[model samples]
Target: MSEKRSFLLQKQNDAGKLNQSKLLKAEENARLLVTLQKKKKEVEQLRLQYKLLQAEQSAANKRIDALKQKLAEKARCKEAPRVHPINPPCLETDACLRQTAIAYLKARKQGNASALSRHFAPDCNYQYANNREVPNEMVMNNIRELWEKWPQRSYRLLKVAYRDNHVELIYIYKYADQRNHSIQGYAKEKWETNSAGQIIHWREELHPGTSPAESAGYRLVPLNIK
Candidate 1:
């Protein structure tokens, strides 16, 4: 009876050890599951962040493309051709007159009277319709006043004729005041050059009702003086 009791006690001890081992293994598996869940959450967060970054990068690229297109359009507009072009075969005697006239027009555009005066002779005569002739010195003041009165102006040549050191130009004159009052009129101008190719006589006439037909056979050509 004593031996049997001892053997039963040993069996109970073995069973307890086995149960403890099983419990420890289950606890270790639960810890591994917890660690796996945390790792999965971290991976999910990283995926979401990557998606946001990709979206932002795509938007940035689109904006860059749009800006590039806008700049290209501006460049194209800037590269558009100018209205005036340089042409050859300008008359021998009238070449200086053409250059002087173009320079005068350019000076008017820039409001530079000194530059305009370089094309005129010392004793130049400038006259308008039904008006007394003015000295060359008066030109500077007159042009200054004209530019002051008409702040915005444009002169488009319609026709030109050259003969005997004299040239005639028909042009469209556009003038605008500070009040935005604008008018466009046709005008005829005659210029006579001295031996030194300086303009000595300048005559101008304004024709609001009729256009001059004398230049019908000629196309307005640019001197390309500038």
Candidate 2:
């Protein structure tokens, strides 16, 4: 009976000690949980601070970009300068008919209808291939018609001579047809007596391709066509 009683008492004491140990362990777990909650709160605050810093950085970048754009515009304004054209510009005077022919050629080349009408006299004549004489109106009309037909036409001045009222010129007529062919040419022109030395009648000869004898001639005279 005594031994059994002692065993029973030892079991009861062991059970009480185990209960106390369990209470201490529970308190330790509670303190650790509180520490974890505080750490979580601190982490959330730091994340908020980081997000605010990122937003500030983004706004600062936008402001810097805007400032750079404004600076670029100001630089562009400083770099660019304005220039004005000279009024009543000085005109080039090379020779008598030379200047006139140059003006004529420039106007003719640009297909300036108004310029052509001013220079070309109504009573004009032209002589073409085989001593053929064509009217001045016909020659002028031919030029206008041909230019209208071929817009990309060009003429190269080969040679030119002028003395008092006598004028002569040579040119190679070309179109954009990509043909490596050039015609040797000569023109004899006489200014009209009534029209203040305007070209009235003209005659021309052309050495076709490489032909010295297989040549062509043209004559042109102008009259009032209206």
Candidate 3:
């Protein structure tokens, strides 16, 4: 009977040890499952961050491309040749006439009275707006007075038309008076040049109704004159 009792106690102990081992295994598995879940969450967060970075990079690239296109369009407009409405077929003497006209404008802008006098004939007739015809000397005096009144001035030639010995110029005139009051205007000028390329007759009509925005669209061609 004692041997049987001993055998029964040993069986009971073995069964209890097996139950404890199963419980330890179950706890380990639970810990491993928790660790695997934590790793999975970190990977998902990393994926989300990578996707966000890619979206931002794509947006930046699009903005850069848009800016490049705008710059290219502006460059094209700047490089395009201007076409004048009154542009006609070229003449043999047109180049000389154009040069003289441009030189006269440059001298006027420089406020160089002596240089201006060289382009005019002795009997040159000058008229401004609705004013009466004035002698060349009187015109020079008037120009000097104008220079005194408006110390800062610029002329932007818009168009030039030539017919025979006559040349027409459309220009924008901008000036700031002694008090720093600014004024912008347009002038239409008709000039008759003698065979010696001297200005014999000049008529100018001024229009002060042009808006600044309207004048800004015109491009200025750089002139190199001595």
Candidate 4:
């Protein structure tokens, strides 16, 4: 009976030791879980802070870019050209037209008539969109009349293109009488050259795209330009 009791006590003690070890293991797992949870919260906070810092940096860069742009614009404005009382020939055209225009502009600047006036052939006629024909005499007369009426009247070439002497002009014209408005127009002049490379006969068509001739030409040319 004593031997059986001793064996039973030993088994009970071993079982108690096993249970105590299991309890200790469970407590260690709980501590590790708490540490993991704390680390997770710290990572989330760092991520949020990083995102906020990135957003602030981006905003600051955008603001800096805007300021730089404004400064560049101001610098450009300060370096802008000064237009004179008698507007010069700023036309960018072929050598022939450019030379002619420059001479005309210099004469006008010196309070003289344009040298181009003598080149106008009396037989030449200009056709309008209304199919009205105006003689060279009429056109020249109108130019002189307009010039006299508005002394400050002048034209400037905004752009130029020449493909085989078909010199095209995108121009801007303004008069003192029409201070609030300016004329924006395009001119395509066909070439007729003299032996000296002077333009003898220039058939000028103004505001071409609206004309029947331009429409016909565009149809023959390309889809991209039209």
Q: Report the CA-based lDDT of candidate 3 relative to the real structure.
A: 0.75
Per-residue lDDT value at 166 in model 3? 67
Q: After superposition, how far is residue 2 of candidate 3 from its true place, in Å?
A: 99
- The sequence of per-residue lDDT tens digits that candidate 2 reaches over residues 1-226 is 9999999999999999999999999999999999999999999999999999999999999999999999999999889895432111112212344456566667667887667656655556554423344544565776787566666656555444443334455555555423533333333333332225556556555544532221233121111111
Whole-model lDDT per candidate: 0.74, 0.57, 0.75, 0.54
Query: Which residue pairs collide in model 4, if any?
Result: none
* Top candidate (lDDT): 3
lDDT of 2 at 210: 33
**Best-first order by TM-score:** 1, 3, 2, 4
* Candidate 2, poorest ten consecutive residues by summed lDDT: 217-226
TM-score of 4: 0.36
Candidate 4 regions with alpha-carbon error over 4 angstroms? 83-226
Each candidate structure's TM-score, on Cα atoms with residue i matched to residue i, is: 0.50, 0.39, 0.50, 0.36
lDDT of 3 by residue, 1-226 (tens): 9999999999999999999999999999999999999999999999999999999999999999999999999999999998543323355344555576677779888899999988877767777523455577877887898889888889887666666556667778889987889998998777777767667888777889862221232222223322
Candidate 1 weakest ten by summed lDDT? 84-93
Q: How do the residues 45-124 of candidate 4 rate in per-residue lDDT, one tens digit apiece?
A: 99999999999999999999999999999999889996432212223324445555445444443335445555444433
Residue 45, candidate 4: C-alpha displacement in angstroms: 0.4
Looking at model 4, residue 3 earns an lDDT score of 98
